[model samples]
Target: MYYQCFFFLQIDRQFLRISTVPLLSTFFAELDRYSPRLMEIFSRKGRQAGKEITQIMDAISKDDTIHTRRACVIKSLCTYLNEDPEKLVKAYLDSDFELQSTMEQTVMGVYVILIEGALPDDDPADIAVLIEGVEVLSDLNSIAQACALLFGLIYCLNLSYPQQLKCT
Candidate 1:
């Protein structure tokens, strides 16, 4: 049954891709024709955000650079949560951070774990998404992929975002 469900999911996802390609292409072509300046601004902003995210990720994945450069990244991450960077860093390093877990009780919700190497030459980091403290997905290739899956699970399960990260 699990295999059958997975097969259907794959088929559905492939069908979505097949059906949306031309629709998206036509939409974008029309938007470009209607407002070339708007399209250019969107393209430039997207490329700039992509480059910035890539730089931040690269810094985060490198243990040495992280020590010196993670301030901006950490601040950006915690901005929506209204969290203190020092405490968050400590909790993250100790593997004690949970999205919805507190000292008194653990809330039932999805959480993401990103494990990076201690050394610069080490292998790439691994990402995991858990629910109710149980890992549901592991060894995801990237934070983006893990986050995408996390959002998908939240939507599919009809779960609310964590309180602190509600704005995110």
Candidate 2:
């Protein structure tokens, strides 16, 4: 019985390897055909557009009002995901007292929290991205970078977005 099981497993592995080659080749062929058009649509002056976008994002990230709005948005997203909004992220004033008090309330899951000062002119002190209560990234320079990283992670991990998000 053990030998038969081992033989079937080997045959399955070989079959998978043989079948995957054609699929991979076809996928790459399609990619090659479309890559130039994609580059044309997404690139400008050979990456100058990307730099300009990054600059704009950095400026937006520095705005205190935007940070406040983003915190609210995060809470809303948590609610949409059927998660506890309070557990998603907790914004705190960039003060030692507040930080010490709030540190104890951290929860598990993927989330981001912004620490900023009270003044409108003050930039965020920190932006942290956590997974399962462990910090994966912190003090990201711009919202764009953080977003790109999260998107890349989702793609690499083969995660599916929520149905509502996917429909949009």
lDDT string for model 1 (71-141, tens) is 33433344323443222222122254553354224332223233443444343344455554555655554
RMSD of 2: 14.8
lDDT digits (tens) for residues 1-168 of candidate 2:
111111222323443465543332343355446544543443342254444323423433566354343333333333434454445344555545655334544432233343543454455666554433445556654333343333333344455643333421
Poorest 10 consecutive residues of model 1 by lDDT?
1-10
Off by over 4 Å in 1: 1-117
* Root-mean-square deviation of every model: 10.1, 14.8
CA-lDDT, candidates in order: 0.40, 0.41
